[model samples]
Target: MFEGLSHLARDAKAWPFEQARNLLARTLRIRLTDAERDLAVVLINSGKTAEAVATFPALAKPVILETGYGPSGLPHLGTFQEVARTTMVRAAFRSLTDDAVPTRLISFSDDMDGLRKIAPNLPNQAMLAEDMGKPLTVVRDPFGTHESFGAHNNARLQAFLDNFGFDYEFVSSTDCYRGGVFDKTLLVALERFDAIQKVMLPTLGEERRATYSPFLPISPKTGRVLQVPTLERHVDKGTIVFEDEDGTLTEVPVTGGHVKMQWKPDWALRWTALGIDYEMSGKDLIDSVKASNQICKALGGVPPEGFNYELFLDEQGQKISKTKGNGLTMDEWLTFGTPESLAYYIFQSPKSAKRLHRDVVPKAADEYLQQLDAYQRQEPAQQINNPVWHIHGGRPPQEGSPVSFSLLLNLVSAADAQDKAVLWGFLSRYIPGASPETHPLLDTLAGYAVAYYEDQIKPNKAFRAPDEKERAAMLDLRARLAAMPSDCQDAELIQNEVYSAGNDAGFDPLRSWFQALYEVLLGQSQGPRFGSFAAIFGLPRTLALMDEKLGG
Candidate 1:
């Protein structure tokens, strides 16, 4: 019993890494290997030994970091995924740490790299050189350039940062390394230059050089790799050697390695140099990240912590890429909804899993608002450590009337009580004999409606008023509806009454009335029956809307 008490006490003091399995399952939806679990334990208390552990208590911890985006073309959903993932992980780290310690996030933009032709459909394809070996930031086209392509990519990147509210320090390789931020690491690598050369380039059959070509020339036409001449090494002032055809050896002047450190060594080197703690990269870089681990051991540093997230798939299941031209840009999504909705879409999915297309956004929006509302409504909890809820059962935090753009527009133009149904009437005008209760893209349609009223309706009053012929048609339709039986209750009854009234009034111009209503209500050519819409929007408001159309 005494031993049991001691054992229980010991177990009670176990590290937070013990919770790693549960946390991974709940947060990441991933399972960890035994090795991964063990490493996480060490990682949780990294740099602290058993001695430190005994002397002071600490929580399980992991430094968080992420691969920064490259300043390239408009960032597609995939690039935005990285931003969202990093932001959420930072949030997670804070949650785990009880919001005591600040989490660090690093962003790297490969701006000094040359531009290679990508995405066949990208505009100004000719501007990109056919060389993959060049740094995107280094290459320039014939046009003197409006803004550097690198700068343009940075602008797009900033859009995501602002949209998602990410907290990170941006790093540009051209600037950071050149500014000597990595000078120590570069010098350390130079000291082991011979070791890297042997591994980077080896004799055939002696060993397989795990690294690919490091000094390849960039093909300007095909953007493929081509071995190029060497330059003087700017960092070490040493020269490198190369083997030519027929096994002849030629001494190339020491220049920078012909190619940038292949992604593997570069990954290891950058992490070691910068002491980066974590990086989330694309799935395509999985192999490189693994290879980088091996190189990190060779370079005398631990590999940086990291995770690999999968790419976003389009509706077609193909990877979402800016190059594909099919992926939705951030700008387009923002037009339909707020930024929080976008982040909600990303955070709700596992980073390594693809998100299928679904019409779940409106619900997500409602849910976010609902969560906010619930948070506001909550009284202080008796439990001091209860977890804050991220969402509240997928409902809007607040309530809103199920009003449509057509209603708003009609109200905006209505001159009196008769104009009360003006908006609904205008909206119903867009429907056939029947209108859709829910629009597939109601938000966008609403935006168009608002814009039309603000920019066109108010400014083009003279153009909105129907001439004498249109006035006669509307009056005729109104008279027809008035003559309908008092018992007429259904939509069909109203329609028949308006048609008959039009003929009786000798204005047999129901179609003309519709066209005029469409033009006045939506600034379009044809629309729903004005008479039926006016009945619902209220006859007074409809007529008042007409009055304002002519006079206001």
Candidate 2:
């Protein structure tokens, strides 16, 4: 599907932005006008309302695109999809139009939401354990703050994006919305309260009772849902009020038929209120996005356009979410590989597809560099012409010798910190005795010292002996490793120790040391070379790891 679209996206470059009109005609198996295609990218890039603005023959106002996520828990890979895609749209519009138009990417973290389920793979697993099945709205943070579970989750999301390198302004429902920016929209939604209630009640699968809030409560509110200042309703003023438990009413001013609407209707209201043009979301929200389109016509406003991308599936076949805690974290992945690899993985597919078992960290940096090289060298047609290029634009490798991780770490972690000559000398050994071609990603290793080696030492439980001779070779290597000299603290001693271990195990001490070590450490008979492994991990950690393994 992307292969075909790339052709159009490329050609769309030559034609009057009308190319987006025919872009997905054949791919999505749907027919749309040039306006629709342009609107789709404009919407997907900005939000529904932004697309409407982009279609205007004259400049009306700076296009507004409000991107938001429900802060159910810590931000997950899904959150990145929301913000990054929005950022890409903004970037693309700037690139495509020569900066004649400007875009605003507004991200809302729905910290006001109640906790649903704990994300299975959040870094602080023990912290989120108590709130696994609780309401996110009511759940207290790990720090025992008055902040709800969603606020804490939002903070994590904020940190995640900061780490992932997204440049966008973030708004928390707890902060920005509380100021009453959406009061008119909320009131308009409030007026439709009963009708919206009727529209939603039947869809509740019998688990929900007939209940209504001046605000949208996805489920029936049992206790104090109305206690918060931003959640209460004021009957006398014909408005929803925010309040404290003491019942001090914080009135939000409202107007513009703001007193009636449901979630779907409100989506259209939000677009008009914020002047949003595009917003990309998951397929789960298809019905919601569709309903907004209809409500837009009813309200005499244009519906913001949207693109629905697929969900990421984890190894367990469950959708990957920070709340689920089942997939990789941006932090964990960056430890073993480059940010570009991650960007490549996420941008490789359309927003709606699921990525499973995407490896962020390998056992060593060489393997990671090799993979990045493969991705870099891949044809433009292969990448689906997405934001991966927006990230790494196939730049040539940085000038340096290809050194194993440990040696490179040594250069960076050295006490002096500025020994370029020493660093170059260590890097020169990937070749038998000469320096090999350094990988572009190799420069990232010094900052990842602990992570690179820690990943390497993780037990590869799938290891098996080669043949009889290989098995004998492993045993000899083990014996050699058992006989390290009392005062041998240098890397050379570590290398000799590995060599002796191979000799004792009855294997030729060539590349067999790597296989032998693999059998010993990972239980696999193959892995990165021995010297390279030793280089990244250093003598102390490597020796300690071996001692823990062989007890010698």
Candidate 3:
């Protein structure tokens, strides 16, 4: 369906050309996730994007995609997932249009926001406590790495995004408010202050509703962003009168960083000011999105249309908090998981809630490899369905890793391999002619496997002797594998033999059978597919390990 599509992604058969092909194929009817596919069809048909936000919007406007970040704490996995998922949609949109519609992603930092409370994880609590109600842009950098805390966090976010090579423009709320970029929007907000109040007041409690003002002027005396009530609005003068804490009425221009709107209004103001076309947030922000949309309309602008992905949860089902460091950090994942695997995890079930924990890393790594391996054989239709396609922006790595990350961990456990070289030794025998250079993915995985084994697997390993039934099964399985052809490379064939031994030994649930193998052989509660592990780790070696465990 897409003849010249390969030319669009990259004119190469090596993963580079697949994105273009996917896009080129998109000139035809494309089917994907409900929200994305609907958006693409609307844009491709060149219809109104008011409902979806920006398809030939206003005749010549470019497609704009935005993701927001708060500088309250260092960046986390949630932050990375937001950008990665947005970028995936952007790629999908581009594919549907064949790059005819130019799209831009804005990585917005809300530095103008005040730090309500010091995060428990941030250092120098005494210093942060002193700057209580000040805008994050002016708060002293606890890290001593940037001009302010906002700058420090923003820098970390940028570096993190850059590490993943995301295509986005970094925008600071402080810069927009102070540099006259938001001047016109602020004036509109001042003119329609009552309209904004109508949208915001009902959402707040009685106390907040009484003191609520759309415009939060920066305190002249203390340099803090004040949240007092607006006594008067001077739209003609482009200003508002608000009483300071000392009961003194202060009038400040709504322009030039002198005043900032409360958050919901600020969100609407940004949409109006920047003409943002699309933006996505977590489920927790659904009410905020609704309010922003109404406020955006009140300010004579359409709210950007996007979906609300469910919030990520920590292992215990609580919302993942960047400030409290309650879940897996991107840096933590990178320590033992490949970037591709991490991206794949983020790409999966974006609209569904996920449990973010360290244990998910190895599984993610294996799943990503399995998907990448599947991509080469899949047609264009099937390829797009794979997360790797979107994770790599259509251009995934062509070389598939020979060993699964889980299997590698098991192999490391079985061999008691403490180093990469030791793991590589068994891997060399597993896949002849493969080396760290020849299989780059495996090479990356080898390092991660070592780290994961030491931190997550090795210390937790609990090898127990097999029960009477399991012992008989293991010995039979060992005998079967021992008699197999020395040059045997078939994983499923070896796997069948292992299953036969377990079945013949009368393992009713079969799960218990596999569990016994894991406990007795690998010293773990769970492990990779026994057949695959045997094939990869070598049958002879596996049999020897079993004999040792069984006292043969």
Off by over 4 Å in 1: 1-64, 118-134, 141-148, 190-211, 214-239, 242-259, 355-360, 370-552
The Cα RMSD in angstroms, rounded to one decimal, for candidate 2 relative to the true structure is 10.3
Between candidates 2 and 3, the TM-score winner: 3
Q: What RMSD, rounded to one decimal, does every model reach?
A: 13.1, 10.3, 5.9
Identify the leading candidate in terms of lDDT.
3
Q: What clash count goes with each model?
A: 37, 66, 2
> In candidate 1, how many Å is residue 196 off?
6.3
Ordering by lDDT? 3, 2, 1
Q: Compute the lDDT of residue 405 as modeled in candidate 2.
A: 49
TM-score of 3: 0.88
Top candidate (TM-score): 3
lDDT minimum window of 10 residues, candidate 3: 1-10
Model 3, span 314-333: residue lDDT tens:
89998887557798888888
Taking all chains together, the TM-score of candidate 2 against the true structure is 0.58
Local distance difference test, each candidate: 0.49, 0.50, 0.80
Pick by lDDT: 1 or 3, better one: 3
Better of 1 and 2 by TM-score: 2
Over 1-552, each residue of candidate 2 has an lDDT whose tens digit, in order, gives 111232323333321122222222321122245555565555434424334435653333444556777766455556665676556555544444334345567776655444445655444567666544334545666555437667666667677778766766777654434566666556555555555455545555654433433353222223222312136555456656544345454454444222223346556666756656667778888887766665554444556555777876776768776545677776576665566555545554554455455333443344434544454566644432433434432232323334544445433432223433444444444233443234434445544543443354333245343566655554455455445443333455556666765666555546665665666554545554564555544444455655555553
> Candidate 3: where are CA atoms >4 Å away?
1-60, 120-124, 322-325, 485-493
lDDT of 3: 0.80
